[model samples]
Target: MKNILRLALRAIGVWATALSLFSAGGLHAQSFPSQPVRIIVAQAAGGLVDILARGYATELNRLWDQPVIVENRPGANTIIGAEAAARSAPDGHTLLLSNSATISINQFLYKKLPYDPERDFALLYNIASSAYIIVVNPSLPVNSLREFIELAKRKPGEIAYGSFGLGSSSHLETEYLSARTGIRMTHIPYKGVADVLPALARGDVQMALAGIQPAIPLLKAGKIRVLALTASVRDPLAPDVPTAAESGYPGLNLAGWFGFVAPAATPRPILDKISGDLAQISNRRDFKEKTIMRGGLVPLLQPPEQFAEYVREERARYSLLIKNLNLNLD
Candidate 1:
């Protein structure tokens, strides 16, 4: 009995000593900015992701009273940038601006990813959510989403739609819609949204699911008509445009979300501080009006635990959808 007690006492002593050896997640939260903060943007400069990254960096620089820089690593559909951010030190100084493609959809599109989004990083916040507008050529007699669907049914496979690429949300969203609605539309893939928008205008494709910001120019110029949004609710920016749910298909929520993430081991205290700061930025009325609202998006600032749960749900949802669509791009 004494020998067993002695062994147990020895193990306890070692554990106590190890506990005192170093700090874990929360100890350094108070003085965290030990250096400048770097935000790794996974998209090219001038895009919405880059624009939001710069905007947040600017605001965070002011809040931290330290320089915050953004480094763009746009390519390979966000794999390069995501891997860089995942490989970064978990000191809360390096943050990756992520989108649905990186956090959720990539697992379905590719056979394997270099970094595991759930294991390699901690989701900080879901900045905002935006949905694609289902736009059709004005020449068609489809002013409403219902009319458009009915027309597609009448002329199955005759209504052609364009997307950024084969594995893109634009393409997959339409595929899912077609499957659910029992209609067929020809798929025309383009290099990017810039390339596809003109195709949509020229009627090379009869329709497209496009972003609000890009669709604004064509919408104003009378080049295309937005029938409905992929979001569950109508957009406040364009109140006239109804959502898919409002238009009769309640299961058609294909909204794209954006967020920031740090390496998985990043301290919770530091993550909370950053999340608080981002919430502050997101709450600014003028900021919302100028940035988020202008692009037809609403701020969706969620806590770390909530955001993590959201990511998991999104991943599962997309995984099933991708498998059902049989979309294996890579």
Candidate 2:
């Protein structure tokens, strides 16, 4: 009878402790956003990612009636911003605006990362996704993808392609295509897509994988031709261009994405609240027009856990592709 009484007391103490913690979390959620919320952007100012982050911050501020700031931390492949975010308190006041390369591919590309993508952050929502385009110089003598592949086979290393940088997504796309087709071409790395397009126009390079905005002006000037796109479905802007699936290489249809992440230990209530608020805002027409359409991105918001699984899948996919490319940025 004495032992039974002691066991009951211990159980009551455990239950009381759990209830107190639950109550504290409830209080935290009620008083959430007691101060300014910082959305750290892991890219340079004036870029598409920055624009999107600011747009989202504006909408979030409208919802909470609180100051939402976008802090840009641009260098060292997003490690600087990511580390800052990782070290922040998990009180739901801080978030990271992350991109595809930083979240997915950086793990394998670098020998050491300041913060582990999966371990340090919890996925909040995927903001947008943009498909890559396969553009070739007008002088390439190939109007279609198959024809271009045949020419690359005929010329071997004589055919060269340009990319923004050595380990950029476009470079990986070009390298993977070369791997799948069993073709060899010299890689011409450029400072950015701005440089790559000009090089393509002058016949300095044969082909490149670029997002729509960078390639549009050249396509209009007749400087380059877009033989194919990477969208699973046809892009509304360039419906005439065939998709990579139509071109018989679905793997080439990789879309770059940007999304929100918070420190991993953030309370579930705060995560759900922010996610729900953001999803409603993302579905609005004006936000879509101003941000998504202008930047050639499709608004793609999903639940946090679902987005987390998607990130894991993307990481695994990029792992193989990066390995094939032999990219060693470290």
Best by TM-score: 1
lDDT (Cα, 0-100) at 321 in candidate 2 = 81
lDDT against the true structure, each candidate: 0.82, 0.81
**Candidate 1, superposed: residue stretches over 4 Å from native:** 1-28, 137-141, 154-160, 164-166, 188-206, 245-250
Judged by lDDT against the true structure, how good is candidate 1? 0.82
List, residue by residue over 1-330, the lDDT tens digit for candidate 2.
Answer: 999999999999999998988778778888888899999976656556777888888888988889999998766667778889989999899999887766887788888878888788888888788888889888778888888888998889998898756565667777888888878999987645566778888999988877776567789999999988888887877879998779876666667888888998998778777787778888788887777777778777767877888888888989988876678988
Candidate 1 lDDT by residue in tens digits, 19-69: 754444456777878899999987656556667788789888998988999
- Lowest summed lDDT across 10 adjacent residues in model 1 is found at 18-27
- Quality of model 2 by C-alpha lDDT: 0.81
> Residue 199 in candidate 2 has what lDDT?
87
User: How close to the true structure is residue 69 of candidate 2, measured as C-alpha lDDT?
Assistant: 97
RMSD from true fold, candidate 2: 3.4
